[model samples]
Target: MTVNEPTNHQDLAEAPAATGEVADLLAMLAKQRHFLRFTTRDLTDEQAGLVPTASELCLGGLIKHVASVERGWAAFILEGPSSMPDFTKMTEADFARRADEFKMLPGETLAGVLAEYADVARRTDELVAKLPDLSVSHPLPKAPWFEAGAQWSARRVLMHIVAETAQHAGHADIIRESLDGAKSMG
Candidate 1:
C-alpha cells in the first residue's frame, strides 16, 4: 500500500508518526532476511541442489534468484533510470559454468548468497535512513505485481522490498524443509 504524505508542517513535525511508515518496512526486511538465513542453514550440496520436481527451482537456486533480485531492486532504488539485470544473458549451461556456481563464485553457495544479501540489506537500510522526504517519488517498474500509473515513495519501495523478500523467505523455508528434515522455520 502507498503511504501518502501529511499535508502540513504540524503533521510533519510529529516524530513518532513519521517513523511508523518507514521503520516498519526496514524491520520487515531485516526479519525476512533473518528467517531466510535460518532456513538455509546446515544443508548438503546435494540437498540444496535437489528440486523435488521438474520445476527448475531448487533451494539453492531460490537463494541465487533472490540475491539477484535484491541487487536488481537495490540498483533500481539507487539509480531509477536504469533497467534491472537481464537474466536471459545467462543460460542454464552458462550458470553451470560460472565459477561462483562451483561455490568459488561470489553468489553461488547458500551461505555466500545470504552473506551478499546481508550486504545488500545494509545498503538498502542506509538508503532508507537517508531518504530526504517520505513523499519522494520513484518510478515503479512495469510488472504484473504492481498497479500501473502508480507513483511510489522511498517508503513504499522499502516496504515493497520487505514484502517481496518476506514472501520469498517463506518459500525458502518450505523448500529447505523439503530438502531435509530440518523443520525449525515452521
Candidate 2:
C-alpha cells in the first residue's frame, strides 16, 4: 500500500516471527532491483547500447558494472577469495578490458543485459542468504581503498551493496527514460 508496506503478502503473513530490520533491508533491495528491471524492460538493443552525449556510461553498462561490484563485495564477505574484477592492481590493459566489459557487443541486446543482471543478482542474493553470521567482522582484504585493516560485518557489506545498487538503479531509470519513455520502480 505504501513504500513502507510489505510488497510480499506472504511475507506479511509471517511478520510476527520476522525482524523489521531484516525485512526492511531485503524489501528495499527488492524494490531497487525491481525498479532496475522496470527501467530496462522495453529498451531496444540500440537504446540499451547507446552511449549518449560523449559519456562512456550506458544503461546496460551501469547494470553490468553494478552486478560486477555486487558479486565482488559479496564474494569478499562470504566466499573468501574474491572472483571480482580487481580495480586496485588493474593495469591499463585491465581498464581496456573493463572498457570492453562496459560496452554492448555486436550481439548484445537489452534482453541480454537483463539476463546477465538477473543472473548476477541471483548469485548475490544466494551469497547473502548463506552467510554464517551476518554480524561477524570480515575484512575486505583486497579493497585497499577501504581503511587498512578495516572490517565490516557481512550484514553491513550487503546493506551497502543494496544501497549502492539502489542509487545506481535510480540513475539507470532516468537514463532509460531519456533514451526511451520507460520508467520503473520507485
Most accurate candidate by TM-score: 2
Model 2 C-alpha lDDT per residue in residues 1-186, reported as the tens digit of each score: 222322321121111222455556666676677665565654677877787635677887777777777777767776543545555787998788778766777887766666676677666665555555678666555555777667778778878888888888787767776776655633
lDDT of 1 by residue, 1-186 (tens): 332221221110111222665777666666666665566566655666666544455666665666666666666666762454334455677656542331323335555555565666666667666676656776666555556756676666666677767877777667766676665433
Candidate 1 error regions (>4 Å)? 1-20, 83-107, 142-147
**What do the candidate models score in CA lDDT, each in turn?**
0.58, 0.66
Q: Which 10-residue span in candidate 2 carries the lowest summed lDDT?
A: 8-17
**lDDT assessment of candidate 1:** 0.58
**Candidate 2 Cα errors over 4 Å, as ranges:** 1-20, 81-87, 142-144
lDDT of 2 at 181: 61
Cα-based lDDT at residue 69, candidate 1: 65
TM-score of 1: 0.68
Backbone clash tally for model 2? Answer: 0
